[model samples]
Target: MEDPSLYFPLPTIKTLLQTFYSSFLFCFLRVFPLCLALLFETLVLVHKWSFLGHLLFVSAVVLYTTLVYHFSRPAPVYLVDFACYKPPSHLQVPLHSFMEHSSRFGCFEKESVEFMGRVIKLSGQGERTSLPPALHYIPPRTGHLDSVEEAHMILFSVMEDLLAKTRVNPSEIDVLVVNCSGFCPSPSLSSMVMHRFKLRDNVKTFSLGGMGCGAGVIAVDVAQTLLKLCSGAQAVVLSTEIMSTGWYSGKERKKLMLNCLFRMGGSAALLQSGPQAARVAKYQLRHMVRTHMGASDRGYFSAMREEDSEGITGVSLERDLMQVAGEILRMNIGALGSRVLPLSEKFWYSFSLFHKRFLDPKTEIYVPNFKLVIHHFCIPPSGKALLRELGKGLRLKKVDLEPALMTLHRFGNQSSSSLWYELAYMEAKGRVKRGDRVWQLGTGSGPKCNSAIWECISPVNPLAKVGSDPAGPWFDCIDEYPIAMDDF
Candidate 1:
C-alpha cells in the first residue's frame, strides 16, 4: 500500500517523516474499533482482571503524548516581539545631500534631478537612514557587491540583537525565514543567516525574494504556517530590502524615482510554538491576509526591474503606482475585513459593497470601520502618496496612520522592513498596549497586498529608551513627525 502521508497537503515536512504522521492519523481513524476489540481480546486471553490494566496503559499513553511529547501539537504560535535596526547617525542622508549627489553625479538630467527632488520632498523621508560605508564612499553610491555585504552587516547585526534580547540560542531555532525583495543571491539569505548564527545543520531555512516589499508579511505568513504544521518549531524571520543592489544608477528619467524612494533597513522577529514560548511571548498571531493581483497586467508590472537603453539596470515605477496600490488595498481589505470584522460590520460591509457593485456601480461603497477591529495600524512607509491613499481607502484617521507616516519621514521607504519600523514607532510612543490589535498593510510589486494581524499580549519594550539611541532614526526627530510634510 502507498504511504498516504506523501499525499498530505503540508509542504513543510521532510520526505523521511512523511509516512510517520499520515500513517498514524490514517490508521488511528480507520482502526480505532479494531484496536478496542483487540484490547478486549488480549484482556480475555490474559485474564479477566487485565481490562483495568490495559485501560490504565492507554490513559498513560494519552497523558504522555499530550503533556510530554515535544512534537505534540494543537499548540499556539506566538510572536515574541521583534527588533528593528537603527543605523548610526552618520549614516543619515538628508534630502539636500541626496539631491546634490544625484545632480553632481549626472545620475539624472537637470529635469530628472528636479523630479527626484520633488519626489524626495514629498516622500516624507526627513533624514533617511542607510547602511554605512557604501553610500558614504563615492559617486557610484551602491553596487551589487555592496548589496551582499550590506545584507551580511544588517542581517547579522539584527539577528544577533534579536537572539541576545530573547536569550534564544541559534541552535534552539528550528527554522529560519528571510525576505529580501531585490537581493536573493547565491547560498540564499536564509542560508546566510543559518551560517552566521551557526544554527543547527538540519534547521529548515526558506528565503523569499522578488516577492516585492510585501514579502515580509508573506514571510511571516510562511513562518506562521510552518510553526503550526511542524510541532515545537521556532522560527526567526528577517525582513529587509538591500537598496545597494536595487539602486537605480541609470539615467532613465522614469526609473530615477527608485533612487529617491528606497533606504536601508531591516528587522528580525522571533516566533515560536508551544506552551513554554507562549508564556513569554509579546503577541499572538491572529489572522494574515494576502492578495496578489497578478491578473491586472498594469498592476503586475507597476514596479519592475529592467535594463535601460544605456544598458544600466534599474527598477521602474509605473505612473499609475498609486492607483494600482489603491486597487490592491481594496481587494486586500475586502478579504481581511470579512475574516476579522464583527458579524454586524461584515454584514454591513458586504451589503454596502454588493449593492454598490450590482445595484449602483457609481454609488458609494461603504468602507468598513477597520478601527473597530484593529486598534493599531502599521502601514508600510512605501511613500507619502501611497500611505495617504491606503489610509483614506480604509477610512483610517491621521492618528491611525501616524506611525506609518512617522516611520517614513524618519527612515524613508525601508521596503519590507518598513512595517517593523512602524511597529517600533507605535511602541516607542507608548501607543501599543496589551489586547490591542495591530494590522500591517504592505503593498509591493506583483501589485501584491499583504497584511498580518497581531494581538499584543505584552507591553512595548523599546530598543532605545524613548528615542535615546544615538544611532536611532527617531532619536532627535520623532516629535517633529506626523507633521504635514506635504508641500503640495
Candidate 2:
C-alpha cells in the first residue's frame, strides 16, 4: 500500500456547508445566553428596578448555567485493571517442533509443509507461544467439545485473574461483554461468564461474534456507551479467539497462513463509571474511533473465512489485506486526530488542506504528529511487515514500535487479546507513567480499524506487585526483551 499519510480527501461543498452550520449553531448557543443576561440588566436599568430584584435575577441566571453544564456532560469511564492469560508451559509450541509435527500428521502435502515452515521461520513468533491442548494431538481433535473446553479454559482463567486483581465482587458487575470472532455456541459466551461468576440477575450481557479481532475495542466502546445510561455502573469486557475450532486442515496456501500465526490467549478488562472509580482507576478513557471498509469488494474479501477448493473451511488472507488495513487505519486516525490533536497540530493540518486544495494543488498535505498527544501505542502485531508499514506511516520511532514487536515475539498473535498483552508489557517494564496517554489500535478480518485513547491516572508498576501476584504475561521474561527483531 502507498503511504496513507498522503491520502487525505479534499473537503466537499456539502461537508463544508455542514461544518459551517455546526460552527454557527455552537456560537449562537454561547452568545444567546450572554445576550439574555444583558437584556435582563438593561431592563433593570431602564425600568429602575430595586437592587433586590437585580440580585435575584443574576442568581437565577447563574443557577440555570450551572444546571445546564452539569446535565450536558457525560460520565467519565475508568479502567480499574486488566489481566491477560498465560498458558502453562506444557502448551508451548516450539517452531521446529511445530514443523516436525505438521510433517508427521500425514494430512498435509510436502509443498504445504514447506510453505508453513517458511512462513513460521520468518513470522517473528518466538518458541514460547502456545497452542490449545487439542491442537497438540497428532491428528488434532477439532470437535465441538474440544472447542468448548478451549473457550472455558481461556475465558474463565482471564476472568478469574481480573477479578482477583481488581478485588471486584461478581455481584457488582452491571454489564458484561464477551467477543470471540470465530466461535458462537448455543448458550453464548456472555451467558457462560454470568453463570460461572454468579453475577447479578439484572446485568446487561452482550455476546459479539464474527466481528473479527478489532472487536476488543468495539467491546470497550459498547461498555462505555452502556455505562453512560446509568450512574456508577461497572462493566467487564472479555476478548479471546477459540483456536481449536478455528484450525484448518486444508492445504490451500492462503488458508494455511492462519495455522502459522494465531495462538492461544485471552484478556479481561474491568471498567467503571463515576468520580469514585476515577480516584482508584489506572487510566481514564479519553477518546474512541472506529472505521469499517467492508462496503467495497476489495476490503470485504481482504481477509475472509471461507471453504477452500478442497471443501475445508479456513480464513484466506488475500494479497490486498495490507492495502485494506492501511486505508482503514488512515480513516480511523483521521477522525481521532480531530478530537485529540493539539491546537497547533490541527492548525497545520487544516492549513495544509487549504493549501493543497486552493493555493497550490501540487503541495503535499500534512499528517498530524500523533506522538504529540499519544505517549504509548499498542497496535496490532499481525505480522512484522504490517507493523513496520504502520510505524512508517505514523512516523513512529523504533522505541514506539517495540511494545508490539516484543508482544508478537512473546505471545504470537492472540487475536483480540493481543492489545492487552502489549499494554501489560509496558506496565511490567514500568514504561507507563501518570498522565501518559496510551493509544490502542486494532484491525481485523472485517477490514476494520478501531482506536482507543487512555490517559494514565495513577502509577502502574506490575513488577512491584509480582511478589504477591506473578500474573503479568511478561513477569518472567520482561528483562530478556528488546531483543534484535532480526534474532527472532
Candidate 3:
C-alpha cells in the first residue's frame, strides 16, 4: 500500500497565496498615507508630480522588502548539524556471537542465559549493532573502563563530524549541553566537550544526568531556552549511553534486559539562533512538552539502576512500565494538544474526554487525530513491544511507524540517540518534506515522557550523496529496510 503522505498533496498553492495576500495587505496599510500624499500633490499643485512615480516605486520596493523580511526572520532555535556515532566494524556483534560471549563469560546461570536468548531474539536488533569494548572481550571485565570509553569514544567522534560539517568554530558555541544517563564524570560531560573544543572562556555548559532515554529532548529544550535568552548564540547537544558500566553480571534475569536492548551509539547536534543560522539550518524547533511522573513509586522505579538481590548492580525495567507510560502519555498529549492541534480537533477531543470522565467512566475516550498535526514521529527504539504499543496509542499507520521499527531492527536502542537515528532513517528514505512537522517522543527513566516538535525549514535531499561524513550507522544498508517484521 502507498503511504498516506504520498496521496496527501503539499499545500504549496494555498500557503503561497495566503502569504502573498497577508504581505500585500500589511504593506498597503503602511504605505497608504504616502500614496495619498503623492496623489494630492500631483492633483492640486501639479508640482513634484514626479513624486507620484517615486512614491509608487518606493511603496512597491518597501512592500517587497517587508515580505522578504517577514519570511526571512530567524527562528529561535535551529538545527545546524547533527551526527550519530557508529562504532568500528570489528565491534559489531551479532546475536549469536553475543550469546556465545555471554555464555563463555561464566557470569550467568543456565536459566539466565536462556532468558537472555529469548530477549535477544525479540529485541529487533540487527547483527551489525555494537557492544561496549569490555563486553566485546572474551573475558568481560566488569569494571569502570566502559565508563571512560563511553565518555571519550562516543563524544569525540560525533563532535568532530558535526563541527566540521557545519563549519562552526568552537569559539562560536556560546551554549553547550550534554546528557549521559548512566555516566556522570567529575568535571561533567558538558565541560569535557568545552575542554575538547577549547571553547570561549564564558561559554555556558550544562550536563544532564539520570534523565534516561528522554535526556536528548531535554537537552534540546534547554538549548532552545538559552538560544531565546541570548540571540545569535550557537548550542551543541550530545546524547549517549554507556552500556559498559551498566553491564549486568549477576544471574538476576529481570535486570538483564539492558544487555539485550542497549547498543554502542551516540549522537551530537548543533543548534543556533540567528538569520544566518536559519538560512542554512535543516529544522526549526517548534514546541517541547515534558511530563515527569517520578513522584509516583511505579514511575520512580520504572527504569531504576540499583543493586540486585546478590548485590550486583544493574538497571531494572519495572513490570508495569507500559501502564505507567500510558498514563504519562495521556497527560502529556492533553497539554500538547491544546498547543498544536487545530481548534476544532481540540474541542471535539475535549468533549470526548469530558464525556468519558463525567458521563461514563467505562466509556471509550476518543483519541485525538494527531495525524492532522504531525507528519512524522520519531519515537524511541526501545523494543518491539513498546514500539507497537506507541504506534497504536498514537494511531499511527504502518508507514508512519516505519522509521522507528527499522531503526530498532538495525540499531537496537541507542538510548537517547535512538530518536536521532530514527529521524535520520526518515530523511534517508525521503519521507520528510519541507514544512512538515515531526514529533519526537522519548520515554526515559524518570518515567518521563519528553515530546518535541520540529518543523523542516529547508528541502531535504535524500538522494544527495554524503561526501565527508564517516561511515556512520546508516551507511551501505539504508535501502534494505521497511521489510516486513512480526508485531510481537
Among all candidates shown, the one with the greatest lDDT? 2
Over 428-472, each residue of candidate 3 has an lDDT whose tens digit, in order, gives 877889899999888888789889999999998664433255334
Between 1 and 2, whose TM-score is larger? 2
Cα RMSD (angstroms) for every candidate in the order listed = 7.2, 10.1, 10.3
Q: Please, what are the lDDT tens digits per residue for candidate 1 over residues 1-488?
A: 96533333233443224335456674464356457656765776678665667776667557545532333344578898677777776788887877777677756678887888888877777765564457655576576678778888889988877876778778778778999988889989898888777887677799898888898899898888888765456889999888777767677767887778788788999998755666789888888889988888898788888999989888888888878887888888889987988898888877887989889888887778888879998887777777777777788878888888777777778888888888877776777899999998887899899889999987766444322243233555666656774441
Provide the lDDT at 464 for model 1: 43
**In lDDT terms, how accurate is model 1?**
0.77
Q: How accurate is candidate 2 locally (lDDT)?
A: 0.87
Better of 1 and 2 by lDDT: 2
lDDT of 2 by residue, 1-488 (tens): 86532333234343344344347575586567778888888899999999986897788788867755654456789999999999889999998889888988878998998998888778788889999999999999889999999999999988988888888888778899999999999899999998899987778999999888899999999999987655467899999999999998988899899899888999999998767788879999999898988898999988889998879899998987877887888889889999999999999999999999999999988988999889999998887877888888888988998999998998999999999999999998889999999999988877888999999999986664421358488877989988897542
- In order of appearance, the predictions have TM-scores of 0.84, 0.89, 0.83
- Ordered list by lDDT, greatest first: 2, 3, 1
Ordered from best to worst TM-score, the candidate numbers read: 2, 1, 3
Considering summed lDDT, which 10 consecutive residues are worst modelled in model 1? 7-16
Quote model 2's TM-score. 0.89
Worst 10 residues of 2 by lDDT: 4-13
